[model samples]
Target chain A: MSPAEIQQSQNNQLKFLDKPLQADATTDIIYMMCPMHLLTIEEQVREIKAGQVLSILTDYDGALDDIPAWCRKTGNEFLGIYEDTDHYKFYIRKKAPDNKQNV
Target chain B: MKTIYMDHVATNPLHPEVLDAMMPYFREIFGNPQSIYEPGIRAKEAVENARASTAALINAKPKEIIFTSSGAEANNFALKGIAYASRNKGTHIIVSKIEHHSVLNPARFLEKSGFAVTYVPVDKYGTVDPDDVKKAITKETILISVIHASPEIGTIQPVDEIGRIAAEKGIVFHVDAVASAGNIPVDVRSLNVDLLTFAAHQFYGPKGAGALYVKEGTRIVPLIYGGIQEGGRRAGTENVPAIVGMGKAAEIAKRDMQKRIEHVTPLRDRIIDSALKIDKVTLTGHPERRLPGHASFVVEYIEGEAMLLLLAGKGIYSASGSACSSKALKASPVLISIGIPAHLAQGSVVFTLGEGTTGEDIDYFNETFPQVIGRLREISPYAKGWEGAEDPTCTVKK
Candidate 1:
């Protein structure tokens, strides 16, 4: 099942992680807003191989909703978010090529 | 009467190619880049293409450039954005005394907001010493901004050395390259600068277009925070036509910079050599290490405005100090900072060359300028000497 379908079945409860997830790559978009958060994720996700996690750091409050929504839309797995002191670190694992949604 | 424009530093006429590139965007291609439709997509493509060209001129990545309205706006953004973004890391900032008011005013504003700012001193030639920059650093130093060159004096600072010092301490370094970026080769990597400010008009592009080069991974708070434009760092409907013109200008500047420099340097040298022949006309800024197209000096007996008007009458237009300081009729802070007495500072005159500047134009100026000074000095009471004039506190070396 795609991440969106699993998220729907789980009643849309956001998965909050206790410890930050290990990721193959990281990007910081702190203080950047709106589509940048989503656009950066889309761009970074394509670089990592299937099953490799990509971590994004941002301070924009909107990312809390947009990132997970983007994961659901793109069929990528959202590992969860790690709350930093000033910003949030979001982790997402790239889906296998067969299941990856066309960008 | 022939009009000889000697104020390239003030601004430049748009190149024919740049105007041609911008023509379409003013009417038919007028779509919002944020829109999703076909016209909007086309507009977005134009903006991105411009971004690439602008970035290419500076050897920066396309994503690193943020479009702004003018060089002043970019200067303000660099100072305030970095100051606020790095506030949590520290509260102290360092800037040179010779910075443009755009940078200086913002630093002053930051000072009022509880940040400690140290305005570093400059040498008599208006050049900042990198060792002084090193000495001013504190554990709380978060950012250091210095001008790449003085628009008023045309003195180029040792930004590469200052940038290296900033890097050694892991501090964010910003350079106000509005005066020097396209006029000279400015490589962010080679200079070790984290952010740089430049304007299109300084390179024969439209007046309204400018850019800030924010190196990748250098986090900065947005100066204008409404929309998602400029990757969410600067927000407003894009000035599509102006930005397009700037891109074309940048491309042309990159291709023709060496030729332009070669053409202007000799003409500039002639102006400086001729002007310095008149007694009491002292050169400002570093003689050999200055902008290739710049010639600036202080005429002892005549006021700069008087020289400007008399020269304008003779069809040779020039400026006195910066556009702002000249109009204020006060001694230019840059002159005062460099230890020129206030009386001498009033006589500051600047002549900058451009692509259109010709040998004939320089010859005309060379003959006319001395005549205008002579005329101003003849009618002046102090032409003989400043009998009761305030002490000539000038620290300039003979």
Candidate 2:
């Protein structure tokens, strides 16, 4: 997505956090060690495909804000964010505008 | 949690005397300094009293000092204000690459606005060579800014020498003495600087309190133009309590500067000695010319954040020059510029001994530190998984 679209989607994601969340079993878990400024949405979106829940643990503030916005903009579910001592646990589920036909 | 503060260079706890002096201003004399009423007059006097004390610490006249919200603002005023003031005189500014972001950022801002900036490189000791300063100066060079002492590496620049060059060339010189003032002697007249910056918190004063010393007859435009406050140089309602605290802190610092050097030096020596005992450790900055309270080291292989966390677990506070702890996870430019390799810079740790720090605290740190490093190293991922068991891909171990 263009920088402006990504920004608009990010604005929507912060707004989405104020809304309710839903959870499911098809969630994929991963640890993203890169700091937020270095991490890109394209890099994250490429992994989960469409219609899969993604759980990410990251300490970077940019990632905390960016991932939720990316999820909302791409028509995915941002389930919720949880906190740990060293990192924040973010749960995002992908929604299929274009499913790769995975289970 | 155990309280062991090794982060004085970041910000210091307020001196008790400073806190006591500021207490009455919080409630009793809460009137604005700009008001014409009796309370206003009293408040104004309090601010002037602070101005006097802060000025006296640096041997400047009271009228020369401008109260700023923080040292960063003072830095902005010093760099940008002078650049704006001397627009027709010249547009080139020279600064050391290791300056605090406050100084460096303003210089960059001036660059964007058509002013030319030359970032002079530092020697491996992080000390700026006066000869380089002499070489960098050109016909268009209007200003030279260098920190009086670096907080990151604790290398005090030779501002007195640099000031002489700037004066000789008829260019304005500004020095950021935020980290140097409370710990060392910073006489503005002796230094021959056009402008000097100080933050109270660096010297055990309250946060939100800072001062800029502009030498008399120095023509610099005000960054903030509004009210007739700060002698109309900086126009804002003064931070009265913080200003009062800063005054008391400055007064105490001046009175006890020598004694402070006597107290913190031995502990600083011990911390540096103990950290050096660990294998593959290298110290940063000038060995002899560094701040009396500072001891910085880079422990190779392990990341600084992991070591910091492990140290924090034992309640021994420390700061890192490491990239992992930074917002962008980038190695400190100061460390890199000082000739520490990027891989080595990742393990940088800084320990600053404060007024409250004692030999006993140093002992506790020394006793706990080796274990902290060992534990972190065992899990470092760069080190071997187990004894005699190593992967061919583990280049760090190799």
Best by lDDT: 1
Span of ten consecutive residues with least summed lDDT in model 2 chain B: B389-398
Predicted candidate 1 versus true structure: per-residue lDDT over B119-214, tens digit per residue: 999999999999999999999999999999998899999999999999999999999999898889989999999999999999999999999999
CAPRI-style docking class of model 2 based on DockQ:
incorrect
Q: B138-248 in candidate 2: lDDT tens per residue? A: 989999999988887889899999999999999999999988998999999989899999999988899999999999768667788666677556877888999999999
For model 1, state the Cα shift of residue B206 in Å. Answer: 0.7
Error of 2 at B269 (Å): 0.1
Instruction: List TM-score per model, in order.
Output: 0.94, 0.76
B221, model 2: CA deviation in Å? 1.6
Candidate 1 DockQ vs. native: 0.71
| lDDT at B348, model 2 | 81
Candidate that would win on TM-score: 1
